[model samples]
Structure formats: C-alpha cells, structure tokens
Target: MSEVAMKPEIRVLETADADTFWKLRLRGLKEDPEAFGASLADSVDATHEEICKRLACTDDSFALGAFNPEPCGMLGFYRRQGERVRHKGSIWGVYVAPEARGTGLARRLMVEAIERAKKMPGLEEVLLTVSTTQGPAMKLYESLGFKEYGHEVKALKQGDLYIDEKAMMLRLHD
Candidate 1:
C-alpha cells in the first residue's frame, strides 16, 4: 500500500464508538504503560457499558480518533470542573497504534484536539504530562508551542522503576 493509503484518517469520536475507543485505548496502555496512569491490564476488566457512558457525557470533555476504516488510535482532553479551575484544561490518554506511529497521525490528532480546546469558552491554556522517556512526544509538544512549566518526580512506576514526567503547557490568548 502507498504511504497515504496506510495512514489513518482523523475524526471526532462519537458516543456510539465506545468499543472501538476502548480497544484502541487498551492497546496504547499495553504498549506504553508508563505513558499513562491507567494500565491496560486493569482496563481489560472494564465493560463497554462504562465506556459508553464516558463517551456520551456532554461536558467539557471530548475524544478524537484516527481510523484506517477502523479505529486505530485515540486522544482525550477534559476541562477542570471547579469554577476556579474551569479556564484550564488537561490533555491525556494520547495514543496511536504501533502500526500507526511515525505516520503523523499523532500530530494530526493533537492538532484536532488543540483546535477544539481553543473553541471552548473561557479557556486559558491546555496542559499535558509526558514522561522523560518519551523523547519523541516531548519534541512534538514543544514543536506545537508547548513549554515545560514543571516536573513531577516518580510520576509513574513500571516494574521497579520510577519515571519522572514533565508538565507542559500551551497558553491560549483571549
């Protein structure tokens, strides 16, 4: 197949996409357990019903997926709930299938997420956490104008190793 043919098309995920979203998310957690707080093994016990509820919630949260005619990767973001923190949002659960990596799908997903975030009323900035081991991801975030604001020690643990994560932010001007 050609390069473009192999690349997945990016789109906003809908409520009816619970199973596909869950499967892609679990795959990401399995491939990079340290990249996120959730573990694939732990989520394996979660039912599609739970996922459907999450996806259907109409709030300051949203998910986007990339599909090769089938869901292959996904990203999610949510705004803080408290009135004091409502202006800020956090990005999480960013993952692409192993087969979809290095094809610019992740960047496309990020762009879509960022665009959606900017449209949110009263939003000030978007933040994300990335492990030090995720060098490529860090570079991608930086290229998109995200700056390192701080770091958390032992933010994640896998096996006996503790991984530190860098907190990055991108400010949106009103």
Candidate 2:
C-alpha cells in the first residue's frame, strides 16, 4: 500500500528526531505564521543542540511526531512545575503538513497527548490556546472535551497583524 494509505507511525519524538522535527516545525512556521505563537525569524537561528534539548522528553514534557518515514505532524506538551500549579499542563505547537491534513492525524495526535496527560500524577487539566482563525482546531479541542475559559485579544502579532486566541481547558480530574 502507498505510505499515505497506510497508518503513519506516531510516537514521542526523541533527540535523534530533532533534525526532522526542526525542519517540519520551520515549515509550519513559514506556511502559517499566525497559527503559531512562534515566528520563523525567532526559530531560524535555533541550533541543532537547542532542538535536541527540546526533544529530550521527560515524564512531564515531550513532543509527539507523526512520520510516514518522515516528519509530517508535531505537537508539544509540558506540565507546569511550581508546587501550586503542577496540576496543569499546556499543549503547544500543533501542526500537520498539508499532505497530512484530512487524514485525522491532528485528532489522533491530540488524543495521544491527552492520554499521556491523564497518566501524569497530579495533573488535573490540560490547557491550550488556539488562534481564533483556527476554527477547525478550536472545534477539535471542543470535541475532545475542552471548554473555552477565556479569550485573549491580540494574543499574537505577526507583522502588525493581530491574532486573537481562545484559551481552552480540558478537566481530567475533579
């Protein structure tokens, strides 16, 4: 079967995947700047070591990657560390290449992240911010039990263009 017709492998990325991850991330930033809080200029200078460090997954922080033999989608998750806020975690940098879209890859990645979050001790909720322009993403988060708790106007600015964002939370425990 064609690779695209087969199920892509999805797993927590490791340091070895840094090169592919970085490339895909740069593609995402360049293709859709407003969809992310990060800018190509901000990430263009990132060194290999820095990218490797980011992929060093711990129990509380990690990135997931989808690969049909090459990186096609990515997501990052990190739990807060302060004693007063350790029960919360945040999801960031979600992106799927255009070729990987409409394959249910985004939802699959989110479900994997949520499942991992549920396993972390003391984690009561998972938080994520989606630009208002990302209607499909907002709907996907809502479908996965996330509720909008707040909205931030001008949450992100890309070249004088303001991007509003909605903060959503998924309660995992009482």
Candidate 3:
C-alpha cells in the first residue's frame, strides 16, 4: 500500500470554527450537490450569527474538522434527541475538498468521528445516507464496517434528475 503524506490534524469544531467550516461546507455543497442535502443557494443567506449559533451547540451533536494546516474536510454526528431514540446518532455532511481527496484525510476524519461516537453517552449506532452517486464514500463506509440497511429510490431530486440513497449504519458495540 502507498503511504499518504500530509498528516491530518482532526478536531471537534466549536463555535470559533463556524466561519472556516461554513466556507468549506458551502464549497462541498456547491461542488457536489449529490453528496449533500443542503444546497448552497438555500444556506447562503444565513447570517454569521446563525452559523455560530448552530456551531455553538456543545451537546452530543458535533462537527469534526480535519486540517492539514488548512481546512481540508469535515464530518458531523447529529444525535437523535428523543427520550426513546437517544441511543442512536446520525452521521452527515461528510466532505473533503477535491484537492484533499487522495490524501486519506476523509478516512482519518471518519475514524475519529466514529471514535467519538463510541464514547458518546447512550450512543449505540451511527447512521448515514449516501447517494448512489457517491460510490467512493459508500465503499469507504462499507470498509469501515458500516452495513446497508435499506435503499431509498428517488431519495433526492435535483432539477429533474432523481438520485437513490443508501442508508447505512455501524454498531459501535455488540
């Protein structure tokens, strides 16, 4: 196996990271709409305050950022906040800049996110949705022990094109 250079420094993002995180996230949504649900056009008007407010949430929900000096990629875990559903969390918004794709930054961020999720109180499984268009991401999740539970046809529609999404989950413990 070939070695990956550019040691990735991954950390859980706080409110202070909203600006950089927003920029990177907007780029991801704009560049690859099929991979994400949020569209740049819809979220562009959000004030910095709104952005910071969302990031300031220091609860079970968290956004993890990977920086190889600069912001390279991000992954997030959104905990289900119901009395009965709190045992599960959903992972979303996995993004790595095109320039950073081959460097294993995405994998590093994902592994760290999973590690954090396992440590989260009451969290037993982590779920994620990936469109069929995201083959690499799907394969990466599969390699990391996530199993597909179902597929949703026409899960997303952009203009006239419909996309199918696969729902996958990883059990943190037996």
User: lDDT tens string, model 1, 1-174?
Assistant: 897676688777787788878988888788788888787877888887778765553569888888898887788888989999999998888888887788788899999888988989999999999999898899999999999999999988879999999999999874
Candidates ranked, most accurate by TM-score first = 2, 3, 1
TM-score, cand. 1 vs. native: 0.91
Model 2 whole-model lDDT (C-alpha atoms): 0.92
Give per-residue CA lDDT, model 2, range 1-174, as digits (tens): 986668888999998899889999999999988898889999988999999877769988999999987889999999999999999999999999999898899999999999999999889999999999998898889999999999999999877789999999999975
Candidate 3 lDDT over residue span 1-174, tens digit each: 234554767888888889999899889988999998777888878899988765554668888888877888988888889799999998888999998897777888889888888988889999999999999999899999999999999999899999999999999997
lDDT of 1: 0.85
**Full ranking by lDDT:** 2, 3, 1
Candidate 1: RMSD to truth: 2.0
Quote each prediction's TM-score. Answer: 0.91, 0.95, 0.93
Better-scoring candidate (lDDT), 2 or 3: 2
